[model samples]
Target: MFVEVGPDDFSQQALYDRLCETDRASQSGAVVTFTGRVRDYNAQGHIEGIELEYYPGMTEAALQQLLKQAQQRFALTNAGIVHRVGRLANHAQIVWVGTCAAHRNDAFNAASYLMDMLKQSVPIWKKEWANGEAEWVAAKTTDSQAAMRWLQETDEPGA
Candidate 1:
């Protein structure tokens, strides 16, 4: 498992290749990855960019805990997550989450879990630019609703 929070931009392909190399490619049968990007606009109208803020050690610790939970729940063979900080322009990649497991279901589910947990637990805050004004982005109830779905799944069989 690996967790990183920094200002550098990273590519999904590079991460996957590294994973495959670190863990023999023959062992894991599935690999799942998710990438999130900064959009050009938000409800505030045209967005020039977004600035993400986080507490140094706290942010990395939270992400590491999330990865550990995912590994325990899904029995993932390998997992990695990288989140960008500082200012990012519209269309710039913001985050990447990846997982590899012996089965496809585990890989997919673990990746999804990491992303959701990042949304819920990470201390990072995003400020978007609108009409040359900066506005802090608010958390949406819909995200909590989505999180509830995962909670429900954990109660079901084979979760």
Candidate 2:
């Protein structure tokens, strides 16, 4: 498992290439990826840009823990996550998760789990800037619900 958090521009192609390389090394047959982008509007209506803040060391550790958990919960060969911070415009990539596994189901589930963990556990904050005002964005209940589903008794416990 690999996890990175930085302010560099997000690149889907680069992430895909890295995941493919990992798959080749592990002889995995399937890869799954998910990318999240900033939308033009939030629940508050219009938004121009977003500024993301995170606790450097803690954020990276939390992300690595999520990846490790995903790998243990699913039959994954490799997992990678990259999340961008700083100022970002609408439509820009915000985050990405990639997973490789021997089967499609494992890859899909791992990718989904990575996203769910990121949304719920990662200590990153976002502030929206629009109309010359900036405000902190609240965490969504839907994201918490999604993360809780993976923690149910029926779900496999992660490392």
**Model 2 misplacement above 4 A:** 156-159
Residue-level lDDT of model 1, residues 92-128, one tens digit each, is: 9999998888889889988888887788788999999
- The TM-score leader among the candidates is 2
Q: How accurate is candidate 1 locally (lDDT)?
A: 0.86
Query: Residue 29, candidate 1: how far off, in angstroms?
Result: 0.4
Q: Model 1: which ten-residue window has the lowest total lDDT?
A: 150-159
Clashes of 2: 0
Query: What is the Cα-based lDDT of residue 141 in candidate 2?
Result: 93
Measured by TM-score, how close is model 2 to the native structure?
Answer: 0.94
Residue 17 of candidate 2: its Cα lDDT?
A: 93
Error of 1 at 52 (Å): 0.2
